[model samples]
Target: MTLSTQERTGPGDQAATGVVAIEATRLEKSFGNAAVLRGLDMKVRDGEVVAIFGANGAGKTTLLRILATLTRPDHGTVSIYGNDLAREAERARLSLGAVLHSPMLYGDMTVEENLKFFGRMFRVPGLSARVLEIADRMGLTPRLDQRVRELSHGYRKRAALARALLHRPRVLLLDEAETGLDEPARQVLDSVIAEHRAAGHAVVMTTHSVERGIAASDRVLVLAGGRFALDEPSSSVTLTDVTRFYIEPEPGDA
Candidate 1:
């Protein structure tokens, strides 16, 4: 379903929970002879946070990549804030913020440079203020001047996150964002997610940390056999349930 002109302007009040920010229908992706996604359907509403949980090679990353517009689906349709991915890729990208497995940063560029560069690309208002604010929020202020390659994994991850959030995108996509984060960084991540949802933005993230994922999300989904084996509200599922569902193969899984 396409969004109306008024709805396509930008994120609205947090009360507009019915608005769909990210929609993917009949998504199918295959690499060589192996199909990674099979007719998958997903819809994330504004002011919502959805966490995707799955085993290794369960197509989690592939799904996120497709949503982030970093990888194209062989056959499918993706719409971000009413913009069709294939027909309006450039427009669609304006509303999306993604942090994938790769840091997507220039190793030689300092953390501050990376953020400012992306800020300019997004045309963020008050670029200087935004950069400092995001750096502080992500705890990268001190390391902002340090080259990306000079920082450790945790710091680099923080820099990437800062870059993604600098634009204040309407749709946020993260792939294993918590992988290299420390306790403080994780806390910052949680705060960022909360603020994004509060602003009526949508977030779709893939994580192996089940408990943390459930805790930080409004809904949880388990992907298996290139499809969602289980989908439910976070309030209705427990860690044990998710673990069991991930381990137990579905009818045609193997």
Candidate 2:
């Protein structure tokens, strides 16, 4: 079935639950036979917080890249808000707010300047108002005069988040979003996610901290060997399940 035929515009529920924001099926990605992803499948519902966890080189980043539309899969199909990524990239991308590991900011640009630049790119209405609003929420208005180079890691993250929201995307794709956050700063990120969740936005986050990931997510996915070895909900399962799956016994020693 195609994506556009699905209902993804409003905050609808999935069957008796919530509406799905992202639906990926038979996802496959390979780097010249490296086989980063193997028939991966995932479903994220609106207002749901999904966290992904895996060891290094486990295709976690590769899967996120496909979900963010930064990279494409060789074999599987992806759809966002029912729009096919391969067929209509623009329409599929318009509903996304992304924060990848890469920084797309200029060091010389002030916080406001950077926001305005991206605002223009999306032709976001009420640009100035939205900028100020997000700035205040992120505590960036005080650093409006500071260039991207002069800010600390936490503030820079806030600024980057502001830049992403310039277009008011329906879904948030965060890659290591809380890497540099302090206790208070991390709290803010939590607040941001909660606020967005309350506002009916879907979120897919990649995190290294298992505790934080479990606390923040409704569902958890562990991608290893280009496939999901474990897919379960945080509420019903314990960390022991993931540990048992990841930590295998010695080879032929038992």
| lDDT of the structure predicted as candidate 2 | 0.76
In candidate 2 the C-alpha lDDT for residue 72 amounts to 83
Q: What are the per-residue Cα lDDT tens digits for candidate 1 across 27-142? A: 89988777778888877788888889988777899899888888999998999988899989899898889989989999999999989998999889999999999898898889
Worst 10 residues of 1 by lDDT: 1-10
Pairs clashing within candidate 1: none
- The parts of candidate 1 lying over 4 Å away from their true place are 1-16, 247-254
lDDT of 2 by residue, 137-169 (tens): 888888988999998988888888888777989
Please report, in order, the local distance difference test score of every candidate based on alpha carbons: 0.83, 0.76
User: Which residue window of length 10 is worst by lDDT in model 2?
Assistant: 1-10
